[model samples]
Target: MNDAHLHMLVNHFPIVGTILGLIILIGGVYFRSISIKNTAYFLFIIAAVFTVFSMSTGEGAEEIVEDMPTIGHEIIHNHEELAEKFAIVLYLLGVVSVIGLITNIRNHPKATFFSYAIVAIAAVAVFLSTKVGTSGGEIRHTEIRSEAVNQNSNAASPKSENNEY
Candidate 1:
């Protein structure tokens, strides 16, 4: 598959996985369960890893789509900028998770509290990261197309799509 296709698939892993991890993490905190918290931590770590994959492939993806009728330099720049931020947050999450895992294995009582703190920040990070991904999608897949890509492929067509294709 092309970089765009692969990037799209990898991008969602971070969004969904991060969201799920947030839920599980919050639930674990509420229930005072170590196993559940650790599980969520692992998920967050995995999400971060995929975020890297997405970010690394992003430049190539942009190269493929930059000249498309619906795409523009601004959109690519915006996506690149946002991806940098997302990468930072995801990397932080991964590092935090590593600490979390270590803490859990060593039975550090305070680790749970630390996890809560990290996840709280991670929740915000995840939100921003998703926004970046959506914006990037919008670069080539405008709202009109996005609205119908799944239901009516015709609507997703670029208004000036003929020029590029």
Candidate 2:
């Protein structure tokens, strides 16, 4: 398959994974379960790895669709910008997670501190993921765009009899 297809396939995991990791991490922290915390850390690392794949394929995907009738440069540009920001956050989360995992494994006194750090980073990652995901969806899904939806609704409404064409 082409880069565009590959991108579609892999792009979702980072967003979904970060969200899942955040939830699981919260549970781990609440229960004080090292194993669950490790699982969440692993998921964050995997999500970060997938971000590389997604970003690498994104340019190719843009090239293939940017000129399409409804998909323009502006929408793709927005998505690209948000994706970059989200990727940075994900990378940071991944690094912190790895350190957290290592500290936990060694029974370091600061392990709990690392868990709190991960939670904060993951929260930021989750926020960015929502923005990136929405921007990416808007690139291809014009119906979901606010302006497009408003235009559609206006067109559907009947004009007054006094109004002339």
Candidate 3:
């Protein structure tokens, strides 16, 4: 498949992974379970790896769709900007997660501190994931756009018999 197809395939994992990781991390912190926390850290690292594939394929995908009728350069550019921010956050989360994992495995005194740090970073990553996901969705899903939704709702409203054309 083409880069665009590959992009579509891999793009959702980072967002989904961050969300899942965040939830599990929260639970881990609550229960003080290193294993659960490690699971979340693993997810973060995998998500970060997937970001590389997503960003790499994005350029090819942009070239393929940037000229389409409903897709504009501005929208694509916005998505690109958000994606970059999200990727950076994911990478940071991944690094922090690795350190946390190492510390936990070693029974380091600072393991709890690292867990808290990972949680904070994952929180930021989750926020960025939302922005990135929305911007990316806006690229192809015109129906979800605020203006388009308003217009569609207006058009779908029933006309009064007296005003019928």
lDDT of 3 by residue, 80-162 (tens): 99999999999999999999999989999999999999999999999989989988998899987767989989899976869
Ranked by lDDT, top first: 2, 3, 1
Candidate 1 lDDT tens digits, 21-59: 889988888898889988988998898899889987888
lDDT of each: 0.82, 0.95, 0.94
Listed per candidate, the RMSD to the true structure in angstroms reads 8.1, 2.9, 2.9
Ranking by TM-score: 2, 3, 1
Tens-place lDDT digits, model 2, residues 1-165: 998999999999999999999999999999999999999999999999999999999999998988999888888998999999999999999999999999999999999999999999999999999999989888878888879989999999977979876
Residue 151 of model 2: what lDDT?
94
lDDT of 1 at 115: 82
In order of appearance, the predictions have TM-scores of 0.82, 0.92, 0.92
The candidate maximizing lDDT is 2
Task: lDDT for model 3, please.
Answer: 0.94
Top-TM-score structure, candidate number = 2
Give the C-alpha miss distance for residue 26 in model 2, angstroms.
0.3
Better of 1 and 3 by TM-score: 3
Better of 1 and 2 by TM-score: 2
